[model samples]
Target: MTILTVNTKAFRPLGVGMRQMIALLGALLGVMLISPGALAGGEVRVTVQGADGAGVEHAAIVLRGPEDAWEPPSDNEATIDQIDREFVPPAISIPVNTRVLFPNQDDIRHHVYSFSSAKSFELPLYKGMPARPIRFPQPGIVTIGCNIHDWMIAHIYVVDAAIHGLTDAEGVWAAADVPAGRYRVEVWHHGLDEERQTTGEIRVEPGTEVDLEVSVEVASRPAPRRRGTVPGYR
Candidate 1:
């Protein structure tokens, strides 16, 4: 066999070039790691209450900020089922352009209709599942009701903002992973009187948690009647 001898001096320049390239790549990676957009996000904790200082449940808290370009899940689909002559989850919050399914889980057929300016549609009676889902393209409140059963009612709050949360029984709602920036916060509840909404501004920093407290007025109205054993009877 023939033996080949390696030359050391010939590889000196190549070794120097490789070291320089690695250093340059490392510097670029460092810059990317410290970039502003690469920073961690923050969270917002909201507490909603009524004029009487009682926690308000099912209230919506929406956040609008500079980095609100986020979009809803591509497969986002929500269902509002009718059971026991009432709409399950009386209140729902969804992003604009969301498809909502109205499934009738009750034994009797019911007609679902909404006359809100944002969205107006009617699903004729006789259904387990409609042929297609109802798409809410506009951003506003859409009140749903059954023509036959007036007592069956529900509210859908369509929002353009990417971040929103609903208050729990303790009137606490938290939205996390929000980019740090100035944001406009809006609070809405069904019990409030006409034009029942509150707005405020807040600033969030990187990896920080902000707390907010909001007070709203409650409207005085007769409670909705419960469904009786007979159909169309409340």
Candidate 2:
């Protein structure tokens, strides 16, 4: 019987090499865990009010930073239904390149149209639902109306910011997990005067909270008159 002698020294380098590879992988994972993309973000709470100090509801608050990127929802679609001769959710905000569906839930048909330069489209006498949705590619305000029902009116605000919030009944809006940086904050409301539409810069720090107060000149616009309900409704 011949006995084979195993050389332990020959396997030493192989074991060392395996240990080194494991260390390298651990270091890489540590770096990845501490990378900027993995860092904790901040939060911003904005409160909007009219000159009279009344809370402004349905106000759009958008934030734009150097790292800001607008990513539409996975569905990339939103719906504005017509019920009770009015557009549900009279105001809405969506990122650019969003497709909006107009579903008429009312018994009557509606002619939805928007002449806004951002997205000019018309659904001629649509009932139930339109065959195709309207795509808003530009960042601007698109006023939607129904030709058949003069009182049916709504506004869609196309914004470039992926991080945005709409003021609630308390006139407060909050954006959480926002990347820490200097951001251009914009507060917009349909009733706000043109001069008050613009807001300035805001600095957000990691793990910190920011509060902002904005006041705007609010104007009263007459609501669209309903057909048959009022005398000489247009």
Candidate 3:
């Protein structure tokens, strides 16, 4: 009789423990429902190209998240250096509401100016790093040029997304930690001349790889002056 009583007590505890386990699992399920990205387990790779059947390098690739989806990174801001009277790289990407550092690495001063829909601010002639950074709060392409040096020009495309990248020298890029779902990918290159841009609808699944190729019309830009032109000369 005592053994039977003990067994009953042990069974009671076991049943209670099982109920607790179920409750815990339910809580976890609820969390997963509330935040799908938390449970997303997958990877994706993307490759970008330019027009003329040639690879485009240093271009910005932005991935827009689906509606009612997780938030993406939106920090658009980069530095524009004036070195040897030339703009380094000549192009950069920045997220919205970002501050771009403009440090004059040259021996002379530079008057930077941009006329774009996005935020525009000019840095007076100064040598070395500036006292303040320029903040680009809008999402648009800003053309930067030096008043002192008309030959010096650069571009900054302010964007909004965490899933963005710059093409390497080989015109190739790979984005990781991208959730498994539908996304709209945009590729922008300075060389692309098309007014209407190209976009791709991609369904990214976990542990799967997706390859993309984009062709954009290249704008005709004057060849960069190798050496500073002599004063009073065309």
Estimate every model's Cα lDDT from 0 to 1. 0.74, 0.73, 0.63
lDDT of 3: 0.63
Winner by lDDT: 1
lDDT tens per residue, model 1, 54-171: 7777777888886677776556688999998899988898988889999999889999999988899999996699899999888777899998887788988887788886788777
C-alpha lDDT of residue 35 in model 3: 33
**Tens digits of per-residue lDDT for model 2, 122-167:** 9999679889988898887788998876677798888877877678
Q: What does the lDDT read for residue 190 in candidate 1?
A: 62
The TM-scores, one per candidate, come to 0.75, 0.75, 0.71
Candidate 2 global CA lDDT score: 0.73
Candidates 2 and 3 compared by TM-score, better number: 2
Which parts of model 1 have CA positions greater than 4 angstroms off? 1-39, 70-75, 193-198, 219-224, 229-234
Between 1 and 2, whose lDDT is larger? 1
Instruction: Please identify which of the two predictions, 1 or 3, would achieve the higher TM-score against the true structure.
Output: 1
